[model samples]
Target: MSVLELVEADFRAPTLIASVENTKPPATVVDSAEQLVDQVIKAVGKNIVLGAPLAIGKPISFVNAMYQRAKADPTINLRIETGITLEKPVGKSKIERNFLEPFVAREFDGVPDIDYILDLRAGKVPSNITISEFFFKAGSFMNSPQQQNYTSTNYTHAVRDLLDKGVNVIAQLVAKRTVNDVTTYSLCSNSDLALDLIPEMDKLKAQGMPLAVVGEVNTNMPFMRNHAEVANTEFDFILDGNSKPDHKDYSLFAAPHGSISAEDHLIGLYACSLLKDGGTLQVGIGSLSSALTYSTLVRHQNNRMYNSMLSDLNIYNKFPVCKSVGDSGKFDEGLYGCSELMVDGFMHLYKAGILKREVFEDLTIQTLINKKAISTDVSLATIRALLEHGAINETLTTDDVTYLKRFGIFKPYIKLVDGNIIAQQETASANLSATDTLEWLEKHALGEKLIGGVVIHGAFFIGPKDFYDDLNNLTDDDHRKFCMTSVNYVNDLYDHMLGNQQIKQAQRKHARFVNSGMMVTLDGSVISDALENGQVVSGVGGQYNFVAQSHQMRDSRSIIKIRATTFRNGKLKSNILFNYGHNTIPRQLRDIVITEYGIADLRGKPDHVVYTELIKIADSRFQQQLLADAKAAGKVAKDYQIPKEYANNTPEAIQQFYKKYTDQGLFGPFPFGCSFTDQELKLGKALKTLKAKTATTSGKIKAIANALQGPKLDHNTEILLKRIGLNKPASFEEKITQKLLIAELTK
Candidate 1:
């Protein structure tokens, strides 16, 4: 069956088909990790081609077992392909090592051994073993030689590339459940890559090639009831045992709360305001997402406060686009979220009632829905549009009735009888007067059918423990609202299949993809995944796809959020560089860029306009240098001057302005929610300050001097030190380090 057919089929009733050979090989049920290893060893030749899903979808027991087997047997050559390997970094320097080793040990105690990552970092990776991932978590492998040599690929093409490179063994974590005396395994978190892989693997197997598709069932894995959930028959091996320990819960990577600056909130306020009601939204995972979510909540729940915040920021006067695109009130129609990672922030939005809009499959119905001409209640105009678009015939047939009911055009009870529409006690002829037909449709609760449209569509999800809990706790109906589909569909605007292209694009309207960039050039070139020096920070995942798609759609926009400046070693540096060595999204694809300073609309703008607009949103301290560089390069007029209002875009100015509102309980760091304790939060901030201080020579000297002075500690300081396990130092070196930490904290 085709992929489209597979998608349309219900998960509860999977169609079993005979193979090309008229017989199918049954999946083996392994009782333990040892048995799984033995099977892998027996199935493998000299070389092992392994593929797994990113992050949480990874089969921990199986992979660790494979790693151990590979280690003991030198003849077993292993090639692993995956993405976003979640491993804690081994600190490179003394200070970094001192802080991170203890911190991680304390923070992630009892976490399962991610042996692969550990081996890779320790240079213990067998000479024959190769690890390749298309996208790495940002800054995870900054100094690793092996990772440095690994070339990056886009998210959409990762599976194809892996397969081409001879990935024959695929293993992923699955959720096992027993129903009707049958045990089934659900892909759970990541069916994004698996959906494409399974079909290809089946084709290859039919051609008589050797392939091992393994599903390691973990009882702890939440059985996500969406496109991701699948039957056990899909795999070649189902590894499960009641006696086996439950899969160790890998705590979801929690983004530090309130990491968002006041400036971030300013940018978020502008971006959130631009989002139209009933439009599609795509957001990434980070502090900026939290900021945007918080701002969106404020806009919907407290319009007066939202407006006041915008007014204080002078958003209307600064960006003319804000006056036109910004919505001042709550979302009656709500928004449809389409994102790569269904981060915890979406849960907050869903709970706030902001992520409530639902879009249908047909273009005609979608158009009417977008224009507010049609909803659950069938209107005369809706009927006319449906007829004009050939969605429904003048004389409603049984086929037409089924189609209408399917797309939410007709109420569930509204049936066609003798060429007439009947809803409970009301009946109207198909050829009746428009007014009478409208009255009949409106009298019944026909709109209820479309009320619970998909709130969010994600490819895969990985967030805080609370995020998983939220998903698990949702009612079946609410859970169904969070659809997990393939990255191919989520990342791209059009599908390769001709039939689904138009349908996919129409579903995603008013597309606002909010992504973050480390640095953006004056001419609108975005550098996100890597630095100018060719050091990889994060791999370019789906930013390019979203940006390109934004330009393709008429009303769509890709808003790139960036901080105006970053503090490095206690010195402020501009993120708006004149030029960068690498570009993820080129100047041609640039749509909208936002910084804490302001918003810059660069879409369809000329070189000079782009340069000026970008500079307008840059830190005031760096604007002159950028302007000078642009002028020297003949990109900007020599007479161009920095605007008077934008001159106040200094860090000090932003901090002061942000403090006023923050004091008033707005624009907080952890505005949505934070996982950290109050004490941990305070200590984290202090430790971060100390780390930054240690990076500079003068700061180090100051720290040493403070250590020599040995300042007396108060009750709060002593308690804080004990909380971080530094109150009573065991060694002289530790005692000195403790004194330095105390000095830094007190300072």
Candidate 2:
């Protein structure tokens, strides 16, 4: 049960080695790609010890490849360690013209080890030969008992069963981030084995088991720097590849649109009111997280102004803002980040001169990272520049300075000249005292800082490049200090140093942490099950962990912000329908529900009030329909109408507000960095639409032509036309006509 015991349990096993004669990636990986099919068939025929994690974009490719291999080698047993099976819709929504027929049903109908097929219609896993997992989202997550015990129990049994049956190698395609920590997993750098838990690796290694761990490298994924990393040498064979998954695009999914909602604003507003100028902050990703961060930034920038005027002025009652709060408007101590999703917002906070706040670690060395001693090659320079530019204060104490130096943070009094460290003369120990350290740090702190408490550690696509870069660059001692799971699991060990004032404040500073997006409602119960008609818009991720954690933490609230409506058939409809065929967070657990219209404080509200708020945010066009349904169900009165005040503040009105501001050049699209050309914008929209459309060959080709020959008739247009399935016309007139069509489209 203890991590130490787990490590000791499986420390040794026989090493399974497979030398790949060909290391090059297949040039043309298709459903009928012969080379890959041949390789897989050969492995199956030989009854390879394990089946590697298979990632393929085209569902048919996976089905065909697996089907062929299984047919050729009946005796060869197959096991799938990772990845998910794509499920088509059973019933049609307005979005789908017809009920989508199952595509891979034929391949899986009688396969012995096909495991389980996740039926999207039913939230629960159906009884099947293989395990059926309805939701399989990839991310850097925290490991709770559910993950460490329940999830691991199934896996351990499966692996043990295989081993007993004489299967030697268990090839699994785990998220690259889940392996041993680069910060912690570095000690075994020279060892040719990859492991999930230390005890397993140690046990198998000790038994002289021929264990071969494959490092499934997804190079295109966003790499993050954390107290975890896996050395390249640990994996016997590194299978480098990429996958085209239907992941949440941050640009389209940012605050107020995707995950962020109005309820987040309410909670964030409450949290900001509680936070003192120097307090720390931690938030998960999504609309609510974004709302909290964005609201905090606005407060700091606008000189302690309130964004929305709610009834409670609990601001003063919560935190004691200093007399000179405005001058030190920024979250001076910089809020530390503590949430599972270390998203773009966290990075933005740091870049905005707020992330330089103190990090509190249980370990002394990690205190250095808290003090920013172990500097990021990119963040270090950026933080230093901000300090010099008056964006942040440069008043770190000698203890802070010393720890930073010990941890390799080059700031304040030190400068790294051509890779050599140098101490600044003005910041020498001879000139400082302990009192000055506290005063200086507090006085010179930024507006906000975010320190996160992540549950799941690694996955494809969510980490930063700098995080991986730093882990790879760390020295052995540094790596040992940084990578230890004990150090990284700060939340787990928060109780160890409860008396510490900083840690206590850090715990309290948290406002809210959310579960992942989209909850289905079934018989008035809310659940997060894509299998139950809820398309897994985003994975469960670290939602349950942080939400539960926030509930336990003092002065903190657990908030769930959901769109009042979901986008279906090119229209937004009430997400809270008569029957939420899918439920994520049930009504009992639902504390807060937000829509663009307003917040539904449903925590203890009666069924009547809950109905009121839910319907308030529903689009006016659909509000009457929802009301009729609710009334028919006896949840509300037949005469119940959404208060006119609520109706007055609809999304149409919200859009109007933006349009007015846009006319005055106040807001429209990218208010910050991005520059969009008309052609580019149109192309982007076309691509987005195409992605949402039901995939058909004719539809796909038409989309391609519209994107290429229908954007602009410039030189680039000519190139695009040739690149797509379009053939060149013989006459100049035909070309001119095609170009005219493109010109019209662009206009």
Candidate 3:
């Protein structure tokens, strides 16, 4: 099918069943890896087109088994299409190979390994097997052969392109559990492509095309219901080896909450201030998202604290935009969430009742909604406004009457006939002049029932174990509130074929697509997915699509949050570059560039204005260099100067400001929620400090010398050292390093 047709096709919820009835069941349960390889060899034949979901949904056992089969048989021509294959890159340099490698291994102990990624990086990928991906997890494939030959495509189009290439085999990790004495399966982590692919595969099978759908059942995969849950009948085969004691837990990619630097909170605070009460929001992963969620909570639950923070930061005075755009009060109207990945932050917002805003399908109705002229509780005044705005005709037709009734504008018992309104044993003029008709409509309208709109719409989700647990524990009704659809629908501004009148933009109003970037240039161009040196950091995921959509909406914005600076090899570096060779969201598409220092409103701004605003938000240490470059390029006047108010935009100032808040119990690293304990948090910080010290030769020597000096250790310090496996070392070098680490932690 064409991309448009595929998108326009109505999606039907898969039937939830206890067991497979009509379809053939699995012929055999493969208990061993060798057996899995043999099964794949038989099922795949000589040439095969294999498709798998991205990230956590990838069936590692199946993929590795296929890899083994491909290695043994060069005649097996296999094409694999997937995205976001997570792999840890073995470092190349001394610092990376020595310090960083061991640090990561110690930090992330249980994370699974994707053999294909390692093979691709080592340039040992079999010539017979081809690996293709649409979007990658940030920096997962940078400077590797896989990235050099990466297939660049939008998230929405990726599925279409893969299917067009004749993807006849589908494999995904699934959650299996017994329901009413029957084993049922759920697509737990990812339903992004599976929702579309499953239905399409059914059609292909009916057309007599060779096809195979395999579900690798892992009990560790949280069994979630919602729209993702489906019966085993959906798949032709089920790999149920997870019940074995030896089966390992699918490596949960835990993005441990990063420390929320003062700058991060400031950027988050500004972003939160721009959000409207009843608007639509789109936020991605990371500490910045967590900060924004926390700020939003403060705005809703603790107005006094929120307002005080804003005042302490001099937000309204420092940035005039906050005066008009910032909202210090609570969100009575709440918000709607539409994001590519529904991160844990949204859950916090939802729990706080800040994500309860509902939107309807009709554009005319949505416009009325924006103006606050209409609501679920329809009244005479609302009907009059609709008529006045030309949304409805004076002489209402049957279709108009139906539309009005559907949206609660007209009461269910009321009827329109020949320019007249008819009620129970009463009649009035259809011009809305009759008081009785108005009162009847208001009294009988379906008030909040009509407010059944989706709270959060996401393409896919993956987070801490608690996030999965929360999803699994949601009530059936509450679960439906978090809809899982394809990226094509969630990321785009308008799905022309969504409903009637395909011409108009079809999206919730006041959309704020908040994304993260590595660096932003003086001209407001964003560098997110790659480096200026032509190395891919992350693939261009859904950032561009959302940014484009933000411009298309009337009261929408594309908010790109970037740290003002970053530490590289023990040295601080500015993230606001004078110029960059590559661009993710170009200068033309730039909207609101937010840094810890301030917000740079670039949407439709002149080049000079853009430069000035960007410079104001840049790290104070690099502000002069950036200004000089802008001046040389003739984008800023030679005599122009940055305001003195922004001169305190230094790391020291940020640290001091953050310390004040920390005393008041604000700006915690994991603001919204955390899975770590207090001790772990402390230990993590100490480890980070030690890692930094080990980055340089002189620092390492100093650290070793300090260890030799023999600082006394407390019981708690010894316990902490044991927790990180540093209490006793096996080798002489390890013993020295352990002492150094113990000293660092104790200090």
Best by TM-score: 1
| lDDT (Cα, tens digit) per residue for candidate 2, span 196-244 | 3323543665687554433333332222223323333344433333443
Q: Compared with the true structure, what per-residue lDDT tens digits does model 3 show for residues 460-494?
A: 77776677667767775576467655666677755
lDDT of 1 by residue, 594-656 (tens): 998889999989999999999998988888999999999999999999889888888787888
Best by lDDT: 1
The per-prediction CA RMSD against the true structure, in angstroms, equals 4.3, 14.1, 6.4
User: What TM value does model 2 have?
Assistant: 0.52
Candidate lDDT scores, in order, read 0.76, 0.39, 0.73
- Clashes per prediction? 3, 87, 1
Which portions of model 3 miss their true places by more than 4 Å? 1-44, 71-73, 87-127, 174-188, 196-209, 213-258, 362-368, 371-373, 377-448, 496-507, 677-679, 698-715, 728-732
Please identify model 2 stretches exceeding 4 Å from their true place.
1-76, 83-196, 204-210, 216-226, 230-299, 302-330, 363-511, 519-528, 531-539, 570-572, 628-641, 660-667, 671-678, 686-747
Off-target runs (Cα >4 Å) in candidate 1 are 1-26, 41-46, 88-110, 178-184, 243-258, 378-388, 394-398, 405-448, 496-499, 703-710, 728-736
Candidate 2's error at 9, in angstroms? Answer: 28
| lDDT over C-alpha atoms for residue 440 of model 3 | 56
